[model samples]
Target chain A: MKSANIQLETLVCPSCTQKIDGALKSLDGIKEDTLKISFATSKVRFDFDEEAVRIEDIEKAINKVGFEVIKSRVK
Target chain B: MQRFIFRNKNKIALINGILIALAFIIRWTAGYMEIFTGLLVAASILGLIPIALQAYQALRVKVVSIDVLVTMAVGGAFAIRNFEESAIVTFLFLFGAYLEQRTLNKTRSAIKALTEMAPETAWKLMDDGEFEEIDIDDVDEGDTLLVKTGAKVPVDGRVLSGEGSINEASITGESIPVAKEAGSGVFAGTLLDNGTLQIVADRVGEDTTFGKIIELVEEAQESKSEAERFIDRFSKYYTPAILLVAILVFLFTRNVELAVTILVLGCPGALVIGVPVSNVAGIGNGASHGVLLKGSEVIRDFSRLDTMIFDKTGTLTQGKPSVAEVQSYGDGIDEARVFLASIERESDHPLALAVLDEIGETDYLEVTDTHVVKGGGITASVGGCRVIVGNQALMTEEGVPLSEQVREDMRRLERSGHSLVLTAVDGELKLLMGIRDPIRPGVADDLESLKKLGVKNLVMLSGDNQGTVDAISSELGLTRAYGHMLPEDKSAYVKDLIGQGEIVAFVGDGVNDSPSLALAHIGIAMGSGTEVAIETSDVVLMNSDFSRLPHALGLVKATSRNMIQNIVIAVGVVLALLASLIFGEWMNMSIGMLVHEGSILVVILNGMRLLRYKLRPSYRLGSRE
Candidate 1:
């Protein structure tokens, strides 16, 4: 699994954080234990299997929850 | 449809806001005309689009969000033909979200600045003897890079040629530009103010100190404090409890409007966001000032520290000792000097450094079987002679008899607050060196400020002799001083202090001080210290400036106070609205929603105050030494 840090546009409140967190956690290739959604910094960090899912899919998940993904980097 | 809604969420909210304003004007001027009602219904549905879509998305993931509650309240109001109330509530909610996004972005600007400072390209030295711009990621370790004036140094490396002043503010948070010559270290993201230099890249990408600092700040911002975690759990149950209470109100009084008002008042918006916002802003403030507080918990713990235990050598003093006097006990003073220089060359202790500096440029001796006697000194076999260089205890342990003349000299040096480093050659007392590390400038004033800032028990822990420790302690006016302490002894002292219900903060900058540093309630490391000390510390003073210590403490205290104020404001606003709705009927749906949104802004603005908190100037002694 590769780690990815996704910076999202400013999260307005805790509810938006929960929605984004839930959306990303439900993805097939995301490592659930590594998922962290920071409302203060509006950053979502998680580990995922590249063969099973791509960063674009994760970005899509967040976008579906009404948040914009600003940038993402894989490490 | 989802993409369109997501892209134009703000515009939709703005349009809805205009429609609501139009509805309000028509109601005021036309006495609730049909056109006003039509505009109200249109604004309600328009604002509800994003909220309803967000609610649906949350439902798909099996989570109930604030949008879900707001959407329900809007839909129920629409079903009852309460067009004005529905329009105002939805418009207010969307407007609140817009303000929140703007303010939250301000709170996060510190990290944003850091992320933007990351250099994207580097001038890699090509094999064809020309510099080519390459992506930073493509610049590998050991690659030579050219850093010109006014360009960010793209990788952490050593200057190979040329000279320049580099501003390392991005890495160390120190704004002053430092001169860099051959063999001097430079980090990525620092700008070379002038002069061109070729650097051999040592650390690149995430491995650079700048990258690590960015990662650390991000992680620190993400980590929740105890108060934040408690609020998270509280909000988890509190939101559902509010829903249940709203349901109970509807069942008991048959007043759907009153029940919806209860839901609007009990959103927990301000309470949930209060603590984390304070944490992020406080950490950001510390980062900009060259202080790296590990996380919210560290700040919380540091704010409560009443007792500060200091490691004597590096923390309070300059940690740089100079050879004051070297007296040879035997006729072979020259021979002892060579052995001392040779043996000290193998060690990096401050006293060893002093010895090396005193005997500048000596021939190397074949020293073997070197070992460190913790807290005492070093043992080695040099030139086939068993030479032991250490303190008085090492001499006594080695059974080297101290002559009366040498003993008198040691007594004088000890009385004068000079640490004695004795050399014993083949069971004979050879030489005695007086090493003294001057107390750091501004320490007395820093300690005085710490006391003023509520540090009650200030103590100094040291492995030096009683005379030296006592002399320094008396000079600094510390509450207590413990001498002749080993690493474990220092840790035990810290544990003892903690056992007495005192929150101890240990400040040190040496390898031996790591145990005590880790044992204290808060470990503060001086930036110039060993890597072990830095890694073991919870807070790092990047410039090793003692004056910054008081400022760091003040920051923590301010942050804690800000957090409490936010909590009171958040909870107090909710209670006020709930009470008004339950008894007086003074707050309708729109009023309650307006007040709820206002409380969120209040708490957020309060947290942002920490970002601008200024530390009081440290008290300076009369002489300014």
Candidate 2:
């Protein structure tokens, strides 16, 4: 099972079409082994280990980066 | 949902819930009993179309929107033959969407508010030099425009003719009517107090000052609020997560009913809509009140701030000064007669004028070797006395004897909030004039208010000497102060604070303060500051009221709280609805829809309350000691 952390990739607000980068390189609880976040998804993608981190934690990490993690396809 | 959408976030949430209830009633009440009996259920399903469209958009963008979670919950109930539950789920989802949209619009209203500030038309100068009406945007650069009494200047430009007082309270936040003569600069949205003027337009359309303001606000609006950010990421994996859980439950228990119930309960419409809806409402509240918060991210960051810092000269003290006292003692002198004659005619400084105006502008011989120290005092030679005039440092550097009379007088002057200048004549003490920069009115009250409002630290930062900074800071009862900082140093200090995990905001109003302002968590630029400061700041305080700093923070904190509450409410409703489907079996489409819609209403209502935030409120007295 993948880490429960989800990531949504978006550009910085109105700066340009370029991808949003870091204001915070390390986010709270993002380092936990149960969660892994990547902002490669144009919208959002979540990979989760049911035991490691709750879905709420994943939402939190994405919010920290200034982008919303909306719905995603179930693979 | 229709009613909620029109009323804004809270209203939308309520309407969505109602529609969801109607859907559940139609789906379950029919129960294949009679086709005509399914009117409520049919309405609920029909209502889902709008939500589904948003969900589809979410998927196209590759992010699972909260709409999907809602849709799944309602659909699950439908599959389980719980028509009422299904309809309720969809209705609740719609309500959440409506609430979110409404709230978002409010938060993003900065541009909308600015656009409405300027009048729709300008007096265009036609070919024959006759004035004709034209759209404000159509007025071009270098075009001459006529402005009459009570008219907003169409563009940022210089007045070519006419003189009058202009009320610049809207754009630059200068409350006093600024006198505008030929060559006086004017901005796009200031009122002409009395006189008509011809202005040469420097910018037009999107390039105008007002246009730039609108663009800045719009740019800020596009950024997501903290609540929106969370829901955005949450919805991505949340939908699939719930679906997987339903699949897992079915596989483990071999009960399709339990699986469908889990799906119904787990749909996260309320959860998804809750946060963004609250953020939007908060944003709208800020805009309506002339506070422009860029986005939810700003709102979130503002709440965590630990230190509030300010630039002293303009941000805290009024940058105006006056001559306080004059003392003259020269042996070859009539005490006041000689020095007054020289200073009145020789110096061009405002301090000199104040002195000359104090006494008559007496005629005197031109002083030779006039020199000025930019941040310090001035000096000149006069009447063969070889006068050395400056602050105490300049007098002491010249080895002028400090007599007992002068010593007592200087010490007394020091105790008063005054700047002292010493004039030494031909190796003899001549004159001492004390001038002072006054503290702004109402500043002490604002600082006290900030302290009462739970600001952890209030610091005054300035490039002036420790004495000046300390004097003002101590008078204001501030705890932390940094004095004698160069422009770069100020910025570095603010940056260091931010790096140390202190969410710090720096307020300033000059080119000197620009770097530090940008480095702050929220750079609150004074409305009356130079243009450089206005461009660098994240938030512009339209008025130079020092109190607005605290108010802006209060607004931010309130907005952040509302957002968090909204998200929790949305999530809570989803969980409760899902549980109703599983263990209690209490959810039908109608009841589920009602609960969902009600939850949205609760969150939206919470967010809307931010509009009621006030600068001051009556307080109940504290316990007697």
Candidate 3:
């Protein structure tokens, strides 16, 4: 089995602008991509295998921790 | 009681009906043609409007509303020689509705307050610069506007160039004026308390912060609390049940006339007006306070929550990192001096800004070859001395070796509940500073009240590392702590707790707390500050204060209790009156009317307990599981 990590370029609450990093990192099979989240502009990428975790699963994982994974169109 | 009766038009309606009924009976007995004619005519004429209005409403609307039932009750009472009773019934019914309207109107002020949120007029550009005179919706983004002292900020934008104290209390609920320099974020609806700012509008209309609040509050589902829903369901059948009982009595007793009396008595007029009147009044009370219970459902759920878990950041702390402590390791340099020099030349992180703000002199340092390395720290040359200011990785990447003590020092700062910044001059570690978000005021006291309310265990969850979460949790005396969490991590933790058989509430600012907030038994959003938080929660605390948690819990408690009292009052008074009418023939029309009127009044006033009720300190946060 192979594993890959992708930085979530903009893992922040679109409303609060707080980083949604550790929250997404806390889920099983998902690992933090060691990237610094830029407030309002940057995303925190995560790396996981497609067979292991889907993007929707990753979103659900992010949601569980009290932070949001906003896809910032502005950025 | 005073607020409820006058605050809502319904109460005023019932009270007016009672007073006029007294006048009608007295004038009828006097029997002077001029006086009786005048009195009867006035009462009948007053009575006709409600009947016509209700009939029109019923024909226009599809449902068999209370208005239709009420209109029929009044007409039937009048047909059977109970003119005063009919007059009072119709008048009270209309009055009760009016009170409900008035109460709702006051509550709608939360939306009206939304209007005051942003400036009504905005600047429009012409061939000659720009002049202020148009609606906010008309003003597009990129329009330049001038905001003066005491003026509400016209739009959400960056300062083209100005400095001032912006009163964000309208949106942020921060009482003190926030000092806004150029580039500091300013929101529309915040008042420019000091200095002038020429801002370019970044967002307008529904996109503006104020517009979003109105949209969110309107979309809030103000469901009836649990206790009220129980009564509401019961009443749906209860009213018809009473009418059937009246019919059965007429069939068995073989007395049509008395059955008519029973029917008139069974109208359940007071019962019908009781609870909603209370609810409308209750909404008044909630608005006067900062808590906005979206619906009766939230109030009901709040009545039952025994355990609550709060997010530590933003909910309990300011969430903005400020420089807390400085430590130095080199000769000829103190902790503050190195921090000042390093941070001055450092990249723009929140920690750097905090340190720079404290030091004040950027002109003192000559920096060359400055660069902010991604995920690493800054590399620069300060005063012919090569300097590297950043986290540990920046130095490690630059081949700067650190002693074991420096690592220990960084660990100590992190354990103390702050992020640590490492600074090295000439490739040797020289400075370390701890940066942290301060605990919000009144947090402990609010938690203490939740304890009194029988909250079993207080849990602190954070995306920050375990060390930071543990330190804050222990400091706050919370029972459990989970750290190094990502957004998805919070929901899983909450689900785990719920799986363990606990009714839990998640209190957060609503931004990062979306999944957990949605999944919890209740989701409480920080008032109006953060958009997503307010948009996606059950309760909106108009003021983002930890102090409000206790008050919100208390309100739900009081409201739930009142709803029960109302249901009992509604059923008890009507059922008792039915028994009295059947068993006690001595009870005449006037006296029967009096008992009915009194019971309705009692139930109504009882419901009003939600209005002026005082909450005494009762429960404390009890630890369990």
Candidate 4:
């Protein structure tokens, strides 16, 4: 298992976090329970299986939900 | 076109506003209903693009957001042929969102400001023994770096060789320049004021102290409190509930305009944003001022603290013992000090260092037969004369007889809480040195400020003897004092106080105090304390400064109060808008959107007040001396 933190541009509204969370949860490799998205800081943190998914795929999923991903780091 | 609409949202809002004004002008001046209606339709369509796109994205995720409510309201107004209301409402919604976005970014500026201060490059030593500039990320532990005057220290390291003053305002929020020399530590992001330093990096990248501070503060601002969590849950069910109420109103009264107006007023935007803004601004204010309130929950708990427990040695006193009083018993006092310094120079005890420090510039005499006592002082023969340097029991064991005046002096020093060091030369009392740890300067005034901030009980707990504890406690006017307290005893006492319905905050700067720090209602650590204590603490006073304590308390109290005030403003405005829509005649779709957005701005402006919070000057009343 690997963890990643994705920074996004400033989120204007609180409910936008739900939209981002739903997009990330639908991916196969993500551990749904470990997902935390903070609207105040506009940061997304989650743990996923490396064998099942790559970080670029997670970024793509967020972009597909209409929010741009500024950067992503895998830890 | 979709990309253009997303990229130029502010532009679209501005153009939509122009169209609305032009339409009204045509209706009032020219009385051309056809051209005015055409302009209104154009404005509504232009303003609806971004709002409709956001609503569609939310719906794709199966969520009904405030954007969806406003979009549906605009569509319903168009269906009823209310072109003016539709155009005005969409323009107001778009303009309101633009303003909200701008002000919300200002609340997170603290994190942005800290990231800007992060050092980006270093001058590292190359293989040829010369220095080369490199990115900070490329620097690693054990890499030697050179720092010039007016340059930032690129990593946390020790000064291999240098003498200068460094401004550590970024690390400790104290802007005073500190003198640095060989073997002294320097943190990343601190500026060198005047000299050059060659330092070897002990920690690099994210492991540096500045890096940890930024990461901790970012996490602190992001973490939610109880009020925020409650609002998150409230808004989840609230937006959909408002939709249901709008549908019910439409079905009962067959009033489409009234139903759409209700949807516009019940967006819950301000209520969703109120608490988090207060938390973010409060945490941000604390970071820039050198106090680290770990999270929103810490802010809440710290504000309600009633009893504050202090560890005596490091928290209240300077933690370094020094010679406070001295007396000469007989002749050869200067010779006795030379013997004392000679014996103490061979020992590395803390008290020994204190005695040696006091007897500066003394001559070292050649001697032999140095014997160590288990719990007493050392006995050594110096310059053909036997010198007994220890406590009273050690003197007695060495067959040194004490005179009547010497006994009286011992009693007097002990009563005053001094750790007595007696030196006897050839069985005659020669010197008496009373050593004690002095209280930190301005601590009394800080404690008084804490009292004014409404801490009901100020207590001290220590491992020292009762007489010493009593003397220090009486001097500071503490409410209670406990002596000879082990770490577990301190934790147990804190637990007992909490059990009796007292909110406890423990302040300490030692490894042994970690347990008590963790068990208290609020754990405040000194910045210079051990990692264990800092890790277990909920609040950190950078630089171990006692003065920031009162400022921290005042800030938290003001922050929590600010949170409550924001919540009231948000909820009260929503209720007032809904109440007016139901019974009053002045309510409309355009007015509802305007007031809804205005309330969000008000709450944000209120939360921003924390950024300028300072402890009132009256709190420093006792600092004059």
Candidate 3, position B595, lDDT: 60
Which CAPRI category fits model 2? Answer: incorrect
- Give the poorly placed runs of model 4, Cα more than 4 Å off: A49-57, B122-169, B172-187, B191-204, B399-404, B622-625
Clashes of 2: 51
Q: Is candidate 3 or candidate 4 better by lDDT?
A: 4
Best by DockQ: 1
Looking at model 1, give its docking quality level: medium
What digit string (tens of lDDT, one per residue) describes model 4 on residues B40-126? 999999999889998887888788889889999999999999999999999988888788889888888877887779998999999
Clashing pairs in model 4, backbone N/Cα/C closer than 3 A: none
Q: In model 2, which runs have C-alpha deviations exceeding 4 angstroms?
A: A1-75, B1-112, B225-230, B240-267, B278-292, B327-338, B341-345, B348-388, B392-402, B415-417, B423-431, B495-501, B527-530, B615-625
Q: Using DockQ as the measure, what is the rank order of every candidate, best first? A: 1, 4, 2, 3
* Model 2 lDDT tens row, B592-616: 5466556656765675576566555
On a 0 to 100 scale, what is the lDDT of residue B14 in model 1? 91
Sequence-dependent TM-score of model 4 = 0.92
Q: What is the lDDT of residue B19 in candidate 1?
A: 89
Question: Per-residue lDDT of B148-210 in model 1, one digit per residue for the tens?
Answer: 889999988899999999988665556789999999999888899999999999999888877
lDDT of each: 0.85, 0.63, 0.63, 0.88
State the displacement of the C-alpha of residue B315, model 2, in Å, after optimal TM-score superposition: 2.6
lDDT of 3 by residue, B287-309 (tens): 54666666666776777886687
Which of the numbered candidates is closest to the native, going by highest TM-score?
4
For each candidate in turn, the interface RMSD (Å) is 1.3, 13.5, 22.4, 1.4
Q: Using lDDT, rank the candidates from best to worst.
A: 4, 1, 3, 2
- Model 4: which docking level applies? medium
